[model samples]
Every structure is written in C-alpha cells, then in structure tokens.
Target: MCYSSNGQFLTQIPTWLIVVAGWFVVHHLSQKRDQRKEARERVDQLVTAILSIEERAVRFHQSDSYQGDVARSLLFDIQRIIAKLKRHPFGSFVISPTLLKELRRAVTLKNFDASKFTRQEANSAILSNIADAVDDIEDQLEQEYERIYLSTEWFVVPSQQKNCR
Candidate 1:
C-alpha cells in the first residue's frame, strides 16, 4: 500500500509540474510574439515618417522659399518624429547619432544658404544627405526586423516528408 501511494504521488507531481511548465512556456511565447508585432508596426510608421521627411527636404532644397511654409512643414515632421519617440515604450526602431546629426546639419544648411545654393546644388547636397539619413535609418530597422523574424528556418526536410514528397 505504501509503495502504491508513493507511486501515485510521484505521478501526480509530474502531472502538476507539466501543467505549470506548459503554462509558463505558452505565456512567455505569447508575450514575445506580441512585442514583436508592436515593434513591427512602430517601425513601419517610423519608415513612413522618414520617407515623408526625405520628400519634404528635397522639395525644400529645390524651392526658392526655404524659410517659408514648406520649410516649416519639413521641420514639423522632424519634430513630430521626436515627439513620437518620447512616448514610445520599446525605444525607436532605429535612429543613429550620425543620422540625427546629418539631419540637423542638412536643415541648418538649408536655412543658412537658402539664397546662395542653386536648386541643383541644394538638391545634390541637402536633399542627398536627407535621403542618406533615411536610408541609414531604414537599414537599421530592416536589420532589426530580420533579427526578429528570420532567426530560424528549416534547413532540411523531415525524413518522412522527404521520402513521401
């Protein structure tokens, strides 16, 4: 009777342990998946903002009125991005110091040499720097996306599947 009771207790312990462990694993996986989804959505929005900033910078560079409403609009976009980052919990998808500095310099150059730079030179210099900053940020975001989504993939077919199909 004692041996039987001990065996029953051992079985119950494994059953309870399995239930708890399974719950923990599922909860952890769910949290990770949710975090990835949030990050992906945030990055997508950030990419759109970066593209808009690049477009606005190009237009500002080409236009005669860098101090006018158009320039203000471009500056507003940058400020908007900064504001968004302030409230974000997981941090920015990607915003490098170099990119930030280049963006600031481009804006400053546009303001200082607005009347000096020909449209073409402004396009080549200020607009090009804006585009480069956008590209760098996007590259960083892409790396993050790949790290999260592409870390694992099947290397070979299973034996049964290989045999059958």
Candidate 2:
C-alpha cells in the first residue's frame, strides 16, 4: 500500500533514520575526546602544583624567618595535591626516597631551629637538591601521562572505581 510509482516501498525506509544514526555516532565520539582532555588537564595541574610546593619548601628553609610561616605554605600545597590524587586515583608515580627524606628533614629542621639556628652554607645545597628531586618527579609524571593516553582509553576507565590500590 505504501509503494511508490516504481513499486518501491519508500515508507518502510525513512530518510531520517540515517541522519539520526550519524548524529549519535558523532556525539559519542566528541564526548569521549572531551572527557580525555579534561582528565589530562587535571593531571597536569596537580603535577605543577606539587612542583611549586617543593620549590616553596626549599625557599622556606632558605629564608631568614625561622617561624612556621614557610612550612605552613608548603603544607597547604601538599594537602591540595593530595586531595586531587584522591579524585583521580592514578598511582603510577612513586615518591622518590630522596624527596621523602627531604620532607622529613624539613620537619626535623623546623623543630631543631625553633629558637635559634642560623641557615648555614652547607645545608643550602642539600635543600637545592631536594627541589631538584621534585622537578624530576614532575618530568617523569609528564612522560607517564603521554604513555597512558597512547596505551589506554582516556577517562572512561573500565573499572568504575579508580582506586590507587
């Protein structure tokens, strides 16, 4: 009954079907790409913030003020980065022992110099080395990001939970 002049059933094959299918495919692909990009940006920001914190930590030790001012600043940033890590849950990067040792030393130094311990030339070089370790971590993280993107599907990780464990 819906046949055309040439006996073709035009009503059975609606033209809009093809258009809708194409639209769905494009929309899905765009969303995937956008999500990947956003995830990458978040990772980059976390790395940069951590690196900056390490620099501040070095400067704090190097500064004349022996109070808790510098350590407080560095702690604030470390907390911020920790929060971000909780959200993304990418545990690929490991904290270097040297960096961890430096952080611990900074705490000890603060306690020891609570009243009167002047910054000496010998210790300044050690602080610089700690800052350099932080820089190395950042560079390693950037490379890891590139590898993750190339190897796996971006933000749509198969596991619903992105636990570091």
Best of the candidates, TM-score:
1
Instruction: Point out where model 2 deviates above 4 Å.
Output: 1-21, 89-125, 152-165
Candidate 1 least-lDDT 10 residues: 156-165
Off by over 4 Å in 1: 1-9, 64-67, 86-94, 111-118, 121-123, 144-165
TM-score for candidate 1, please give it: 0.70
What does candidate 2's lDDT look like per residue over 107-155, in tens digits?
3444335576455353565565656656665665565555544445444
Clashes of each: 0, 0
lDDT of 1 by residue, 5-108 (tens): 67787878888999999999798667756766776788788889878887777766776544566666776777777667555532523446666667656665
